[model samples]
Target chain A: MAAEAVLAEAGYAGFTIEQVARRAGAGKPTIYRWWSGKPALLIEIYARQPLDLSGTDTGSLEGDLVAALGRLLAFWRDTPAGEAFTALLVEAQHDHAALEMLRAFLAERSFPLAELFDRAARRGELATDFDLAAGLDLVSGYVWARLLTRRLEDDSRSLSSAARLIARGCLRR
Target chain B: MAAEAVLAEAGYAGFTIEQVARRAGAGKPTIYRWWSGKPALLIEIYARQPLDLSGTDTGSLEGDLVAALGRLLAFWRDTPAGEAFTALLVEAQHDHAALEMLRAFLAERSFPLAELFDRAARRGELATDFDLAAGLDLVSGYVWARLLTRRLEDDSRSLSSAARLIARGCLRR
Candidate 1:
């Protein structure tokens, strides 16, 4: 928890194992023994954080998508943990280990959304041949693009609109 | 040119005015007088390079989008300039001036796509209320997400699929 806080505040450039150990009141050896390094520690911290996807089922595909995306936007806009996760993504570009951990983290995060798609299909809301992976990529991609380009703010209007468009596009005729 | 080459090979971390000066056979003062800093220099180099969008007019929206995105993917995958541009994006996160430059670059790049959307609207292919900005964001966002996450390789299958999907979604029946 202290490490997560430090990561959020310090960013990748400022995050150091020493500071984390000091803040957590743990010995260097204790931290190192349990985790390989910062990437491993960050992954552990990220995995422990709760991602609320239980409310993703809203009966209608459109409602479910908007709610799921709305929650994701809220997490990014409202939480320090979200900032930490972004810092890790940037770090992943140069660090292979971090890239692996980040990929694993992303896959785990996407599972719930995949399940949501499955529910939509079962409800006869989705086309039989719809590409779920591609659809999810578009949904998540729009959010990431805005966030990375600094285009995202407190506004959820665009998020909802994009979700609606995507839902409409992917629905069964 | 030297600065661009240096940026491509050495990346932002290894790039410096000094190295660029030596490579260019120019003095530090000359480089300093013309450009304020690395970010400014990078922006200049990026702007000077040509981005071909002339042939983006393929008549059909799907054809144009696929062509435009295909060119973009080629730039990122095949050119050193693309590598330089990506390094600039990473640098933008830490530098305010760089962020401004990156935003400007992105805006400039989006203009041609906007023109394509205008053509689509004039052709009565798009819904009157279709959000061009949001649509473009989804298109560019998907490409960028894949690029940043290292999930993109030589495959343009997903790009074409997304383009077709977006085109279908935005079209007025």
Candidate 2:
């Protein structure tokens, strides 16, 4: 909670353990004892944000992807999670340890897409040789590009177009 | 040249006009007069990197995309331009002017894709209703994601899969 306030108020540039400790009325060593560094604290704070996708399944890959992407973008746009993520990415660029942490975090968070893809496969909708990783990369890449560029608006048209492409490409003929 | 050297040696974090000036054996005011700031200098340096797609058009949308993506990834991995770009994106998050500069630079650099798309249209390979910006966004997003995650290695399989998805999605069915 204190870390969230610190990031929201001061941004990543000023998110120091000392500042977080001061805000939480705790000692610096106590905070350090719990979290190894800024990236670790940032990740924990980000993981607390909800990534609800319970209603994204629409019985079609395109439909599911459109709903999924829309919800994901909204989550990033409307929460401190977005700032926390961008901060983590920037830190990863500068720090090797942070980079590893980010990759691991990302690898562990693929459950949502895995569920969607599994559903698609069960329905015989996916191509026999559909590359799941490739689809994930394309979709996530589009989201990251929009987020990094601060263009995370409700552009349903583009979202639909992207979903259609992936569906058609990955769908069984 | 001095800017490129500075970026290579010191990276974005250590990159400063004063440092560049020192490296170039020139005055800071002279450097400032030539380029407004680090972002401008970075953009200019990045633009100098060759984005040569000379032989990418293989008479098929998928072929062209595969070649183009491969070349682009190689370009990023083999040059200081990649560092300049990641630096620009990181800087954009913290500074408004850098964001605008990055947008402008990206807009100006769309010519390569435009040429490819136009050729596809002429060849009757593209769907009449294909959304150019959406396709571009998907492809470029994939590239940006790979670059930022430090996975710009040659993965022809993923590249081919992505191209197939776009081609099938955008093809005139």
Per-candidate TM-scores read: 0.89, 0.97
Model 1 / residue B142 / CA error / Å: 0.7
Error of 1 at B97 (Å): 3.1
DockQ of each: 0.56, 0.75
Model 1 regions lying over 4 Å from their true place: A25-30, B25-30
Query: What's the CA RMSD for each of the models?
Result: 2.4, 1.3
Clashing pairs in 1: none
- For TM-score, the strongest prediction is 2
Candidate 1 structure quality by residue, lDDT tens digits, A65-144:
88887777676666655556666767777677888888888888788889888889889987666887778888888877
Q: Which predicted model would earn the best DockQ?
A: 2
**Which of the numbered candidates is closest to the native, going by highest lDDT?**
2
TM-score of chain B of 1: 0.88
CA lDDT of A71 in candidate 1? 77
